[model samples]
Target: MRLLQQPWPLKLIWLVLLGEACAALLNREWIVGAVALTTFGLTLLPLYVGRVSGVHIPSGFLVAIAVFLMATLFLGEIRNFYERFWWWDIVLHIGSAVAFGLAGVVLMLILVRGERLTAAPITVAFFAFCFAVTVGVFWEIIEFTADQTLGTNTQRSGLMDTMWDLIVDCLGALVGAAAGWIYLQGEQGWVLTGTLREFVRRNGRLFSPR
Candidate 1:
């Protein structure tokens, strides 16, 4: 309820959900409706967790995540962006890697604040990079399993496709990890980190022990 009062996520939430509903009703694609509802529920998980734990996540970040889901699930999976656009898969892989990398940094920061872990810039960056890449690899595995068992062509070009995806995921994670390292070190003139700092400020309690 409180989340819906926010501007960005609120608007997008209604738009996407409504769009999905319309598609489902008009096109008789019950799967689209189910996926849309499920996506919305999953999208709310972070905010729900943050609220319960006294954490504050920036609206922009949440919105960005929602948009990513929109692109990945609705546009890519439902609309067949992967088939219609040659570069769609590549773009999504890079975006997911970066998102996951940033998420790793956030989790590491929280752990450090909670005294559950020690913080070192390079080591943290490496962890973030590894975390993102590991997730990407797992996704590839899922694709493989789905293709083999469910007769889906998610792998597209077999080993070649998987390798290229992993490569892109690695590259994107590297960039995100570097950014996270620089941001934590308080390097000046960095825009993304600046936004992160602002996020921390707005949600200081989230980064500090209760």
Candidate 2:
């Protein structure tokens, strides 16, 4: 009978499990899954739900997960995984870095400018970059562990690959974070009112009456 007052207990558990499954599916990572589950369930859910009350999903968090997953899956540490050689490997890393950078920039723009919702856009972007850096570190650690424990059939030079990956990761994050900061510089937050007005005035053919 006492539990009836907090029916959220049941629903919360379900959300936790759901988030864990999503994290695993997205990153193919178990630890990330565990973190995702706890954060979404314990922190993200109740706070946002109470703040917005009646919303089902934390849509923005979902978007972040999606971006992270896509970047992780396709970017860098390819072919011998630890070896640095040839053009295609470099190309793959560059592509991954660009994709990740663009993803961060686009997400921040949408969150800060288009949606007008954020947890301090600059701070969020910074922390996101930091997280990306940490991820780069973890990638090397995982590789080393795999080499030692699971054998090095797919592994190669940890030092070179790790260093290059770190560099690429930082560069990507810096570029992306800078773009987001520029896009959201002031209080009005990336408004294009003047630009839009000028466009409409010149293109009277399109919006003349329709």
TM-score of each: 0.85, 0.39
What pairs collide in candidate 1? none
* Error at 196, model 1, angstroms: 2.5
TM-score of 1: 0.85
- Report lDDT (Cα) of residue 81, candidate 1: 87
Residue 110 of model 2, lDDT score: 34
Q: Once superposed on the true structure, which residue ranges of model 2 sit more than 4 Å away at CA? A: 1-87, 94-122, 153-155, 186-210
Best by TM-score: 1
lDDT for every model?
A: 0.81, 0.47
Tens-digit lDDT track of model 1 for 62-90: 77777777777877887888889999989
